[model samples]
Target chain A: MTKTRTMLAAFAVGLLTSTAALAGDVRIMWYSDGVEGEVLKDLMDRFMKDNPDIKVVIDNVSFSVVREQLPVQLEAGDGPDIARLANLKALSKHWLDLRPLVAEPAYWDKNFGDQADWMRPDGSNQISGFMTQVTLTGGFANKTLFDQAGVALPGKDATWDDWAKASKQVAESQQIPFPMALDRSGHRLTAPDLSFGANYIGADGKPAPLDDGAKGFISKFIGWIEDGTMSKDIWVSAAGSTYRAGADDFINGQVAFYYSGSWQVPNFSTKIGSNFDWVATGSPCGPANCTGMPGGAGLVAIKYTKNPKDVAKVMDYLASEPIVKEFSERTLFLPAHKGVIEKGLNFKTDDAQAKAALGIFVTASTGLSDIARKLPGWAWSDTVYGALVTRVSQAAAGEMTLDEAYSRIDADIAAKVKDSAL
Target chain B: MAEISRQTSQRRIGQSLGETAMVPVSLAMGLIDAPLRWVQKTFGLGGMAAFFLLPNMLIFGIFVLLPFFINFAYSMTGGTALFLSDRTFVGVDQYARLFDCANYLNPNTCAEDTFWTAVSNTGWFVILQVTLMIGFSLVTALILNRELMARSFWRAVFFFPVLLSPVVVGLIWKWILQRQGLLNFGLFGFGFEPHVWLNDRNWAFAATVGVSIWAHMGFYTLIILAGLQAIPKDLYEAAEMDGTRAMRVFTRITLPLLMPNLLVVIVLVLIRAVQIFDEVYVLTGGGPGTSTLFVTQYIYETGFAAQLRNPGLAAAASILMGLVLVVLTLVQLGLSRSRDKKGARK
Candidate 1:
C-alpha cells in the first residue's frame, strides 16, 4: 500500500509539470465499484497540489453506466480526460491509437519488459494502452476437503478428466454438498479453454479461428457440469448476488472446489483464510499444458488529447516497476510486471495452498489476450449459457440425459452461427 | 319664394365655413394611426407576452423542448460520441430501429410495447391510485366530520408517507427486501424460503408499484379529504329526511358536488403517472431483461446511457409518446366537457 501511494505521487508529479497548453483542466470520467473512485481522487489531489496550474476534475459513474455512456459523452464533446473500460468485444469498432502518443516502443520495452504483450488485444505491435494490472480466472480447490475425501491434487501429469474424477470422489463423500461450483459468467468460461490451451471461438477478431486445441477441452468442461460433478445452482445468479455467494458457500464448508476468476482472490482470503485451508492451481488441463483466462482493462489515452507526449509518458511510467508495483500493491491486484511478484505485495494468506494457486496463475497462461472479445456470437454465448444452464438443471432433475443437454447446446450454437451468417 | 331661397343659401354657407377645417384634421389623424396600429399589432403586445413568459419558456425550451427535439433529430442521425466527426444525418432511421430493438430485444414489444408499457402502467396506476386515494380520503373526511375518534392523529398517520422523501422510501424498501433483510427474517421465522424480492422480475415490479402507492396515496388522501369537507351538508340532511340513506346521499349529493375537484384530481394524477422515473431507476434498474422498463427509462437509456447513442432515436420515441399523451389528454378534456354539459342539463 505504501509503495502504491508513493508511486501515485510520483506519477502525479510527472503529469503536473509536463507541457500542457493553457494548463488545461482535465475532466476524467471513471467508474466506481468501491474505493477506486476515492483512490483516483487521492491521485488527483496529489497532482493538483504539485501543479496548481492545472485542475483535475473527476466524475465517477457506475460501471455499467460508464460503459454505456462513455461514447455518448465523447460524442457530445463532454468526455473526461481518462475513463475505465472493461476490455470487451473487438477493438474493431472503438479502437484507440496510442502509437503516436507514447514513448518509442524500444523505450517502452526497456521499462515494461516482456509483460506488455498482454496489453495488445489485436496481437499487433500497436500498443493501444497500458494495463494497470492483470488477473486470470482458473480453478481453486479446498485442501482440507481434498484430504477429507482422500483425493490428491492433480499434478503436472494429470488432466481435467482426472480432476473431474477426483471431484466426483469428493462429491461422493457428500460432507461437501457440491464437489465443484462453476461460475458460468461470460469471462470465466474462457478459463476452461485456457486450462488446455484453447480459446473461445471468435475471441480474436478473425473467422473460424478457434484455439490450438479448443473443442475437446470445451466439451469436457461442459461435461463436468453436465455430468453432475459441478452444480450450476451453486454459482449462477440471474438477479441475486452470484459472485461472492459461491465463495461464501465454499468458505462456509458447503462446497469443495470453487471455480472463479482472480478478481475475488482478496474476498476469498479475507473471508475464509483462517477457518479452512485452500489450494489454488492452474485449472487441471485436458491436453498439453494448463492455461488461464486472460483479460485485463487497459488505460488508453483518447485521440483528442491535449498533450499526447505527456499522456504517453504517464502510460510509460504506469508500465514501469515503480508505478505498476504501487498500483498492484495498493489495489490488491496481481502486478503486471515480471519480477514484481517475487518482491511480494499484500497477499495475506497463511495457507500454503492459496500461495500455490497464485504461483500456478503466474506460470499457467502467458499474459495473453483471450479470444472471446472478438468472438462472433458473444450474444450466442449468452443464449447458449442461458439455454445450457436451464437444460443442465433439467437434466440434474432427471428430465434429460447428459448427451441430450450437450446435443441441445451444440444445436443452438450451430443454429446461432447459421443465423448470424453475419 | 325669393325670401325662402335666400335663407336656405345663407344657412348652408354658415355650416360649411364652420365644419370645413375639421375634415382635413380628421383625415390626417386617421392616416398617422395606420402604421402605428400595424407596428403595435405585429410586435408590441406579442413581444411583451413572450417577454413575460420568456424565462419559463426559455428554460422549457433549453432543458425539455430542446432535448426532446434534438434527441429526435440525433436519433435520425445515428451519431455516436466518438464518431461525431463523421456523423451522417439519416432521417426516419430511428423509428425503423425501434422496430429492430423490439424484434431483437423483445418479440412482443416490436409494435409499441415500449410506449404502451409506459402508458398502460401509468393508466392502470392512475385509475386504481385515484380511486383508492379519493375513496380513502372521502371516508376519512366523513369520519373526521362525524363527532367520532382522534381525527388529527389518524390524519397525520395517513399523511406521513407524503412527508417522507421518495428516495428515502426507495432506499428503505431496498434494505427491507434484500436477501438478509427484514422480509427474509420474517420468512425464515415462518419456515418459508426467503425470496430475493427486489431482485426478481415479478416481485421487483410489484414492489415498485407498491412503493409508488405507499408514497403518493397520502397526498391524494389529504386532497380528497379537503374536497370531501367542502361539500354542503344540507343536501345530505334533506335527503336523509326524505328517506334517502347514507349510500344514496353520497351518490346523489356528495359525489355530484365533488365532481369539479375530482376532475382536477384526475388530470393532475394522469400527468404525474405518465412521468414515473426515479423510483424505478433507483429500484430494479429495469433488470431481469427489461420487464419493468418504462418509456422514460428507455429514453434515458438511449440519450444518456450511451448503450445506443442515437439520441435522435430517443427523441423520436419521445415525440411519439408526447403526441400519444396529448391525444389522450384531449380525450379526457372532451369527456369532462360532455360531463359538464350533462351536469348543466340536469
Candidate 2:
C-alpha cells in the first residue's frame, strides 16, 4: 500500500512537470466579418503548424452577433482569450496591458508602424490593439455611370465642393433618380460631418459644444440634402448593399454610385465582373482636407486570463508582418502594420482599379478612425451618429429643416451622454 | 419491517422534494442516508440531518436566490444596476428614472415614448396575436373535435410551424417579405408595383405582425385543438336542445369552455412578444432606421453593444422591464378575476 501511494504521488508530480513544460493552447474568441475572418482562419492554420501545441480555437460569429454577445460573455467571465474587435469601443470596458506583449519599441519604431494613441483601452497613451486594417469608407463611384454621362473622371485634388458639382452634373447628364447613393446611416452621415470638422464628444483639447467645425459640417450636410445631389430615396430604397445582389444595381446602371466600405471590393470583383468599371476613393475634402474613415478589426486579449504570456505570444504571432500581410492582401484591406503598403490583399482582379483604390488611401490628406458608427451597442458614436442619420433622413424627406435635424441630433447625442454617463 | 417502511418513506420523500428542490430531495431520496450514517457513526447521533440539508440550501442560495435578491437590489438603483461589481448603488434612482419623460425624443407622443411605446406596441401585438391565435385555434379544434374530418392530418398541418425554429421562421419571413419575394412576385403578376414591406415604417409594423401571426398560428392552433377535444360533448348536446345553431353553441358554450386554455395562450404569447428579440432582429434589424427597435434589442444595444457596454444601465433596464412585466401580469390576473366575477354574476 505504501509503495502504491508513493508511485501515484510520483506520477502526479511527473504529470504536473510535463504540463508546466508544454505551451498551453490560447483560447481565442475571434469573430470575423466579411472576408477578414476567413483570412484570419488561414493565418491561424499556419501559426498552429509552427507551434503544434499552441492551438488557437477561433469562434467566428457574425460581426453583429458577437457585438451583442461579447459584453455579456465578458461580464460572465466566459470571454475568449482573444477577440477580433472591429471598433475601438471593445477596449473601453475590458483592457489588458499589451505593451509588454508587443514587439520591442525599436522593432515597431523602425517599421513606421503607427496605431493612433486613442486605440488603447485605458486611453492613457499606450498601444493596445494587436492590429488595425486601413478602411476607406464613404466614397465609391461607378465608372460606367460616369463614362455614360461623359463626366470627367474625378482627380485626387478634387474638393468636396468640386466633387458635389461634378456629381450633380453627372446625375443631370445621366437622368438617373440621383447619381450618388451614399447611405444616410448615422455613421456615414456624421463621418462627413465630423471629418469636415465636428466636435462631437467633450474630449480634452477639443473645441466646446457646437463648435465652428460642427456648424460647418452641418451646413455643408444640409446643403447637400437641399441641392438634391444626394437623395434620401437611396437610403430608403430596396437596393443591395455593396455586397450580395444590390451591388449589381449600381453596376447595371440603376444607380450611378455606391458609397460603402473597402470590404465591397471582393464582392464587386467577383460579381461586377466586366459589367462596369468602378473606383474607390477618399472622402471629398471641402477646403480643409480629404479624409476617409480608417477602421478595421483588432485582436485584443481578455483582462483576467490565467496564462497571459502564452496568450500574448499567440497574439504576437497574429500581429506578425507575415500574417498581417496575408490578411490585408487577401482581403484587399490597407495593412495595419507600418511599411506594409507593398504587401496587402489582392481582392480585386483588375489591377488598375485596385491601384485606384490604393492610390486614394496613399494620397489621402488625413485618415481618421470613426468606425464606432457601425457597431450599435453601447457605442456613443453609433447612438449619436445613428440619430443624425434618422433625423437627417427625415429632414431630407422634407419632414424637417437641416437646422432642425442638427439640433435634434445634438440634443439626442447630449441625451445619450446623460443616460450613458452613469 | 420498520426499516422497510422507513426506506419507503425515505424514497417517497426524496422523490417529491428531490423532484422539486433537489436538496431536501436528496434526503427524501436517501442520498442523505449515507452522509447521515457517516455523521451518526462519527457523532453517535442522527441530529445532523439539518446539517446534511445545508449543502442544498447553500447551492440554491449561491445560484438561484442570490441572483433574485441581487436583481431586487439593482432594481432600486438607476442606470446600470447590475452587479458585476462596478455599479454604484443609487437608491430609487432607477425606478424614478422611469417616470421622467420630458427629455424623451418624441415629445408629441408620451404614450409612444421609448419604453411606453414598446409597452403599447407589445400590448397591441399580444392582443391581436393572441386573439387571432385562440380564435383560429378554437375554430380548428371545433372542426377537428370529431371524427368527421382527418383530425390527425389537419393537426399535423397546423402543428408544422410550431415544430420550426424561430430563426428559420424569421429567415423564411425575410425571404417572403423582401421586395422581390413571393409576395411581390404575385403582386407584380397581378399588375401591381413591388413595395418594400420592411422598408416603409407603416408597412414594417405590418410585416413584423404578419411574421408573428404566421409563425405562431400553428402553435396555439394545436393547443386549442387539444383543448376543444377535451371539452365534454354533453355540454354541447345540452346547449343544442335550446334550439341553438352551431355558431350559437360555439359562442355560448365553446368560447366559455376554452377560457382556461385561452388564458394560457395569452400568457404564452405575451411572454413571447415582450421577449421578441430574434425575429425582429433577423427581419428588419430594427431599421429603415430603428422602426423595428424593440426594448429588448435596445437594452442589449445600450449596455452590451461593442462600442457601448453599459451593463449597469442594461441591468437597470432589465429590472425595470421585470417590474413592468410583473405589474402588468398582476393587473391582467386581477382584471381576469373581475371579468370572471362579472360572468358569474350574469
Candidate 3:
C-alpha cells in the first residue's frame, strides 16, 4: 500500500513538473535557405543563456513543410510559438500582435519598419514580425566557363537576349549541358516578367490578367526551352506550383547561367568552393527596366502560443539590431534592417565571391520596380504566383500553348478570388 | 497417505489461483450478459447478429461514413477556409465549374483545364497500367509456378520490390532514370548518346506506368501464383497423359480455372491504378507537363498544397473520383458474388 502511494505521488509530481515546463516553453518552427539555420541556432543559444527561466526549442523543417503543413496547423489554431515564413501576408491573421507583447514597439518600428507592412494585414499597424533577410531575384553566371570558352561576359545593361546569346556561345564552346536555366518558381520568373514591363496589379488592386509583356517574355522563355538555349529539365521536372531550383545545375557547373535569387549565395559558396568562379549578374534588362522582385522570409510569432510572454522575449532577443546584424553577416544574407544596412557590415565570409554576390544583390535591391516592391505585401500575390507557375510549366512542357496557359492562369486566379470571397 | 494429502493441497492452490485470475473475466461477461439478453429478447436472433456487430458498425460509421458525409458537405461549400463552419455554402457551383467545358473532349475549352487534363491522364493511365500490370503479373506467376532451378530464390527476388516503400521505390528508379543517373551513365559508356528520359512527355508517362508496374506486380503475381497452386494436379496430369501441348493445356485448363482470380486482380488493379499517386508523385511529380497527373494528385494539390487552397473544389473533385471508386467496388462485389454462386453450383 505504501509503495503504491509513493508511486502515485511521484507520478503526480512528474505531471506537475511537465506542466511547469510547458508553461515556460517557446517553440520555433524554422526553415533555412542556406546557413541561416546555424546562425539562428547560435543566436538562440545566447538568448537561452541570458534568459534562464525560458526554454527555447527550434524545430528545423524543410521549406515545403513551412509552405504546405504550417498553414494547416495555423488554420487548426495550433502551431509553433514562432515560425520563419515566406507567405507572411496571406497568413497575417494568425500572427500575434507583438506590439503589445514586445519590450519596445518603437525599436521594431524604427529598424524593421519598411518590411512591417509586408507581414501584416493592410489597414492595420500590427507589429506581426520582422523580415529575417531581404532577397532579390537575379542571375548568376559561371565566369570560369565564360573565360574557358573565350567568350566575354555581357555588359551591366545587357538584355536577356544578350546574356542568352553569350551563355549559348559559352555552353557550345565548353560543351555544357544547359546554356541557361531558370528556377521553376513564379517568384523567380516574376523578376523577368516585370523587366519585360508586366504589371501584375490592376487599378482596382486585384491581380490583372497576364499582359502582353508577360506573354512576350513567356513565349520567348518557351522558345528558349525548345531551341536548347534554356534547360528544359528543371521547368518540366515537376507539375503544379511545386518549387524547384536550378541552383544544383549552376553549382555543378553544368549550366552557363542560372537565374535564381540572392538566397543561393551561401549554398553556392559552400557547394562550389574553388571548383569554378561565379559572379552575380543583377537582373537582365528588358524593354521597360532591369528590375528584380524583392521579397523575404519573416520571423513571426504565432498567436496560438500558450506562453506568449516567453515567445515575445525570444522574438525581442532575435530581432535586436546586434543579433540581426550578426545573423546577416555570418549567413551572407542581405540585411532587411535599415539600421544594419546604414551601419555597414563586414561580412564574415572567407569566400570573396559570396561577398561580391551580396554586394550585387544589395545594388540590385535599389532598382526594384513599383510592382515588385508592392507585391511582397499583396494578399493575392501567392494566388497569382501559384497560377503562373502551374500554367507556365504546363505550357513549357508542350502540354498546352502559351495562349491557353495565359487563359488558364487568368481563370485560376479568378476562381481563387471567387472562392476566397466572403 | 501424507504425500497424497500434500499433492491434493497443491492442486487446490493451483485451482484457486486459476479461479482468481478468471474472476475479472467472469465479472466482465456477467456485466455484458443482461444487456445482451435484453437485446436478444427484444429483437430476436436475426437482430442479435447486428447487436454483436454494433462496435464494428460504430467504428465504420465514425471513421469512414462520417468523413465521407463531411466531405460531401464540404463539396457544397465554397471558400479558402479549412473548417466547414467558416465556409460559405455555394451548392453545386464547384461541380458546375468542373463540368464547364465548351467541348467535353478538349481540356483547353474547360474552365478547370487541369482537372480535365488530370481526368484524361488518369483514364489513359488506368487503361494502360491495368492491362500491362495484369499481363506481366500473369507471366511472372506462370514462370514462378513452374518447377525451375532456384525457384524459391526467384520467387523471393520477384517479391522483393513489393516490400519496399513506394517512396523508396520512386527514389530508386529516379536514381536509375535521371539525366545524370545510372541509365544515362551506362548508355554513355556503351558508345550511345544519353537521352533525357524524364523530360519528354511520352517517355515520362511511360516511366510512371512502367515503374508502378515494377513496384506492384509482385503482389499480384503472388496472388495469381496462389490461384495456380490451388488448381488440382489431376487436371494437369490428365492433360499430360493425353499429350496436350503446353499452350493447349494452359488455354484449356489453366486459363479457365484462373478466371476468378484474374477477375479479382483486374478489379483490384483498376481501382489501384485510378488511385495511383505516391510512387508516381515521387517519380515524376505528375510532370513533363500534366502528362502524368492523376485525380488523386489533383485533389491533394487543390485541397492542401496550393496557396490559398480551395478545399471546396477539391472536395467536389474527390466526390466524383469517389463515385468512380464506388462503381469499381460494386463491380468487384458483383464479380465475387457471381464467382461464389458458380462455385456453389460446382
Best by lDDT: 3
**For each prediction, how big is the interface RMSD?**
8.9, 6.2, 0.8
Chain A fold similarity by TM-score, each prediction: 0.67, 0.76, 0.99
Model 3: per-residue Cα lDDT over A46-93, one tens digit each: 888989889888999999999999999999999999999899999999
DockQ, each predicted model = 0.10, 0.19, 0.74
True contacts kept of each: 0.16, 0.17, 0.84
lDDT per model vs. reference: 0.59, 0.62, 0.92
Tens-place lDDT digits, model 2, residues A160-199: 6666777777888887655565654545555565556654
- Give one digit per residue, the lDDT tens place, for model 1 in A350-375: 65555566666766555334443333
Candidate whose DockQ is highest: 3
lDDT of 1 by residue, B23-46 (tens): 898899899788757766788977
Rank the candidate models, highest TM-score first. 3, 2, 1
Tens-place lDDT per residue, model 3, B190-260, is 99999989987899899999999999999999999999999999999999999999999999999989988
Give candidate 3 regions above 4 Å deviation.
B1-43
- Greater TM-score among 1 and 2 belongs to 2
TM-score-best of 2 and 3? 3
What shift in Å separates residue B206 of candidate 1 from its native position after superposition? 2.8
